[model samples]
Target: MKCIMDDLTVYTPSPPAGQNALVVFPQARECPELPPSGYAPLRGSAPLGRVMLRDGRSAWAVTGHALARELLSDPRLSRDRSHPGFLAPEEWSAEVGTHGASPALVADPGDEAPHRPPLPYLTPRRTAALRPHLQRIADRLLTGMERQGPPADLVSAFALPMSALAIGTLLGVPYEDHDFFEGCSGRLLRGRTVREAATARAELERYTGQLLDRKRHEPGDGLLDDLMRQDGQGSLDRARLVTLPGTLLARGHETTADLVALAAFTLLRHPEHLAVLRAGKTPMTAVAEELLRCLATPNGILRVAVEDVEIAGRTIRSGECVVFVTALINRDATVFAEPETLDWDRPAGHHLAFGSGVHECLGRNLVRAQLEIALGSLFTRFPGLRLAVPAEEIRSKPANPTSDGLLELPVAW
Candidate 1:
């Protein structure tokens, strides 16, 4: 592949770090362009190489399939955002605000601090308790759909609303507040201006604090209430409980909603797979896993090196930011035969869709459950379901590397 650059220098990895690093660039595919917010892969290739980021700083874009996997699991890489000089290049840094740094980045690999429970409110016990409530929400959503009739946009009518409701119910937020939460989450993730993101964070924090206060005085049958009890027990702190639930509410819905929409889109695009799924004999479990793998994002995981380390023969200097492209690794032609082809029955091996290390997504089970029920019920409910708009015309969010917001997925009975 021809490498393109503007004021960027490319470096080929020396012997043993694999061969020359292949530099994937923008314009490699006909898909929607990436949002201008964060660093993400533009294309795929072999080995490691240096590229000048838009800020005029030398950065490494590790593109090799094997090398990306190796680097992702390497302990030398850190996910802590607090490391010195760790922000994106100067140009990018000027656009974002820094939050108080966490000790995660420099903490020892064995340290429990970085691996602290992601959500104090959504504890394992609370998650189990919320199951019946979740089922009720799912049932209500399906019932509403049945009464409203089909020929609806699943993205708008079913997937988005249902996800928002489930996440909100878990966090003690009313379903009516979906639009507010959605806007706040979107701004936090994709805001181009630092001030915008900071404003959103403050608003979210204030909202969560009020909710927590309500839970303390008049507890609801929700995770937030359970967190209040945990706090009273001294097992959780007030600040931790408040902030964690807000983060959970933001993360819980959006990604799963996208996955459900994308999985439907993928199955519909390949009618053969749709037929297999509709047979009702083959378990939906396998199909869900395959969809997760196939739809893996190109951006991978971000981590900074805590110390100088040698890997695959090359020495990685401390303080360098390393990104592992899971999307590229999952599709490695060597590990997965006919990687680009989606096989519903592909045998499960280790895939990085949920990530590899301790930081792997804690909500993996819930996401799988949501996808299974949502996709299965959707296909079963609307046998004639299909896309409303032309595939080429689908609108996506700016700065997002994956499928766009899936505008108006009209489906029919």
Candidate 2:
């Protein structure tokens, strides 16, 4: 409720009605790789504490690693944005209301029964099918970066393009139209206002539908064609057909680009495995896994109680919002020895970077494959890779508060 601030006792809402004082969600971040100082004290205090959102609403923050994972699989907690109790931040609540219920980014497949999506698109076997394609893209990007010379922004020249092209190839979207969807993803991911996000969402929807129409006339090998087959079988309707690829396009690429950049940034900072990477001593698969564990986004995921539930001697009322802190879960000292240190040999399975439960990321396999290829080719080709600017000069704050991405990752090879 109330956080200690150097001898000052500030009360949120005055606590006059006998309700607990609310803790504002954040304060300052002393380290770019870590959470804010204000948040530091809350998790240590209890597994579930009251967190006040902007605009005066409050939610419970799940602080413990075991509890966070348990609750993620608890059917009582729902991520359905359409739910009135869904604790979307005040800024974008209206934007969510503008869209109807579907298996879009707002909810998973079978959240609506009629929209159950085909399962094989991202299965491990199909993901393996994309490996060679991913390698080619990585090689081409590296060659281009080399020609452009040292001191390049990895986010723009490699990470961003690799993601865009990979998702494009998978979805059968034309390579020439990457700029269009990429602009939409930018607004939707980092737009300062709800209007910008809503406009971009609508435009992307229109474009996806038009592209599918074109695909029908000139059939190609895209996962969308799989959806088209389902459409012919009365399994997928037009709206579900359009929403899925748009969801994949927007949801798949940007955070992954940010993540790949973060992985490269972290490796350069530690450099413990720099020589190993260049010499091909450790497998790239292992290196990528460690980077994933060390650099996954440290943020809370929001879910709302669909019904009353009791846990840890507390009753969470229906419609109440719950947040599971991912950082605390992934970096628990008891579970992970020297939790902050990266060890390529350590087994880091079941990590929550892609989240967990029924809503676990559909792109997990694609991302893992992409990371292995991208990070492998990146450091191997440029053995002299290092940050162009000092690490401290790179500010950690993301362009959007909802994300933990660096705006630009400047580096040299």
Which model scores highest in TM-score? 2
The segments of candidate 1 whose C-alpha lies over 4 angstroms from its true place after superposition are 1-29, 32-58, 61-70, 84-132, 139-152, 172-203, 217-221, 401-413
Q: For residues 1-413, what per-residue lDDT tens digits would candidate 1 score against the true structure?
A: 22122211233323225433333221112232211111233332235555443344445556455677667677778766557634332223221223211112112122236535435444566666666666666677767877888656776667776666667766677656666876675565444555665576678778888878766777777666766776787876767765654455445555676667767877887789889889976677788887777666333455678888776566668987665555555665666677667787686445667776666776776676677778877777678877656666554432232223344466656
lDDT of 2 by residue, 303-352 (tens): 89999989977888999988766655566555667666677778876567
TM-score to true structure, per model? 0.73, 0.82
TM-score: model 2 vs. ground truth: 0.82
**Model 2: residues >4 Å from true position, as ranges?**
1-23, 26-30, 90-120, 179-184, 187-203, 398-402
